[model samples]
Target: MWRCPLGLLLLLSLAGHVALGAKQGRVRRELAPGLHLRGIRDAGGRYCQEQDLCCRGRADDCALPYLGAICYCDLFCNRTVSDCCPDFWDFCLGVPPPFPPIQGCMHGGRIYPVLGTYWDNCNRCWQAGNHSAFWGMTLDEGIRYRLGTIRPSSLVMNMHEIYTVLNPGEVLPTAFEASEKWPNLIHEPLDQGNCAGSWAFSTAAVASDRVSIHSLGHMTPVLSPQNLLSCDTHQQQGCRGGRLDGAWWFLRRRGVVSDHCYPFSGRERDEAGPAPPCMMHSRAMGRGKRQATARCPNSHVNNNDIYQVTPVYRLGSNDKEIMKELMENGPVQALMEVHEDFFLYKGGIYSHTPVSLGRPERYRRHGTHSVKITGWGEETLPDGRTLKYWTAANSWGPAWGERGHFRIVRGVNECDIESFVLGVWGRVGMEDMGYH
Candidate 1:
């Protein structure tokens, strides 16, 4: 199977030259599904650029350096004629190609325009009239439909004080991920869906990981965003949108249960009104502590343990400080500015898409969103430049991003990610681990 589309994949493409080169090619090849190659003057239906890309039988033991993935090429082994480039699925996978053959707007071979618009090589499918850049949203859905975190009225934190406490001089690795360090404790990202309550989802997510870490694996609970959505009503709007401060406030004061106890019901809730009714509630047991007063909504769990966290603290937009916090503590909640193009992110280090920049105001429209920043790292682009980025977990579920996580440029506050970072400690005590 081809790991990626067969292409020259030159260093120039790293500088956004892939599209330019594809336009110059004479032939096209459907190298891999969606991994279309406008080619370096090659076609999709043609053989590999090099005879070496073709190999006989399994590629693992083939010992070919230039060939990236297994592409069958032989006539003597199975007693049948075979070419690696032809019918990729029939020879290798033993199944027909998954997609039905459709008359595609042929590129390179000629500029064949199916409609008013022509396919741009290594570019997006374009059409006349209104179009959407974001995958699931309409072109005119505006920015508010999916994004839902209000930027803190003031992201201004005491940078001087924070730097002193975090100790700016600490030597940090070039990269780090809380998931790798903590393993199962770092919860997989969750989908916030139609509801814009990223404030709730991210808050709950960070709390979930921090608590699990602080407890040393004794209490790894997936805290409930639904718990906050319905009950944390002071200056909060549940699914429609809410404040990060308010979310942290609830996790500290009112507290919440596990997602198993109170699953998210806001995905399909009416955006015009309040969230679904609060399913779990708590009563103060004593000493300013609270206990769940009802059974888990999912009766099978037989648990209604209330999870609580400490008041949140801000991580000023210092890259080192943010990295130190994530390494020492756990995931932290970060407010990100999500533009329309952000919805179309498949993979790779994300900066604002170049096509969406400048011009009309709406083309650049964006909304604030809160995401969980789990780690940070740097990428070396072909241009010999090092780009640092933060690995952030979006609330859009495992299917939507790099398995529900995306990397934004780390320093210079790309999209305001580090502008207002917040961290909280899980209020774990002996009772949480069942000692009491």
Candidate 2:
């Protein structure tokens, strides 16, 4: 009887030891290539206890916290962090590790750095830090610098007074409309906020617009700028103010789609479309679903070239004439000093000078200000400031008041204002001009 009991006790102890060994073995197995396990010891000096692994190099890069453990060894393990971190990893390797745990979110299978902005459902505006790289440049240089890689050739030729002539009733069948009559007329509205990929947004917008006009019809529906700005997984500069042309190349290679399809706010249940299962994060949704496969749209354009332009009118001494000529002829992108007064007038105002055009008093009284000039118009404000104004568009979106359109007071007889119009023009290759 004594021998039988002893044997039973021995068997129990052996089983317990095996169980402990199994647990330790599992942890050791997890510490594969590029990972070194560091075991902590107790006061007794014998391995007191918990075992942990310090990931090294490639494994460390793969073990980015934003993507979870799966991404560490799988998709990102072999690839350089530069390629994977652009749209995913929020934490910088060189920066000190954050004390309070940083939270991460996903959009379109890619992780985005969420620091300052509140994620809203309706108006998905992300508050991002200003990247100083984009400042200080002539409009031409800025566009060129931003579109460094994919240079386009076919330039959109604008005649002086095109904006004025295109307005309502001023000139029927304006150049834009006349171009529509031609065999190649491509025009499309680009959705601006979808992906925070402005480079793609602008590039695709310009390309598709030109292509529609030149190849298919007059203008195609506006391509969504939202997709370019928001959906790209390879770059993170969009919401922080990125270029437009670079986005086109990214989308061409990686492809993009609806934000609703990839919820970045931990609201996957609220996703509208079917989930893509083939992506790296698909397993998070659960098993049994087919893997999601990314599909590029057929409308993507691939040509990259440069174009040249001839001066329609040499700028003369008259600043007003120069401004008018630029407004009429080309889509001159410019950067101007913004003042509080410029934001005045909620909607309409009269100004002797363009500087005073958006005076706060006028904006408060009329509830509108014009930042962009399309053409000239005459309007009578409620404040009795009857002034001839130039039609302008605002970057403030449709909900901000004027449905994305506004007017600026270019000049009045009393105030001989000298408004600056920065002109940008270059020839792009005919093939570079994709569908509008």
Compare the candidates by TM-score and give the number of the best one. Answer: 1
Q: Write the per-residue lDDT of candidate 1 for residues 274-362, one digit (tens) a residue.
A: 45787788989876679898898887888788888887887767888888888999998888888655665556677664443433555
- Report the CA-based lDDT of candidate 1 relative to the real structure: 0.64
lDDT (10s digit) by residue, model 2, range 273-354: 3322222121111221222243322225221111112222223324344344433443232222332222222344333112
Segments of candidate 1 deviating more than 4 angstroms: 1-136, 139-142, 155-161, 164-169, 269-274, 433-436
Return the TM-score for each candidate structure.
Answer: 0.68, 0.31
Supply the TM-score for candidate 1. Answer: 0.68
lDDT of 2 at 287: 25
lDDT of 2: 0.29
Poorly placed runs, candidate 2 (over 4 Å):
1-236, 243-330, 337-345, 350-372, 378-386, 411-436
In model 1, where is the ten-residue run with the lowest total lDDT? 1-10
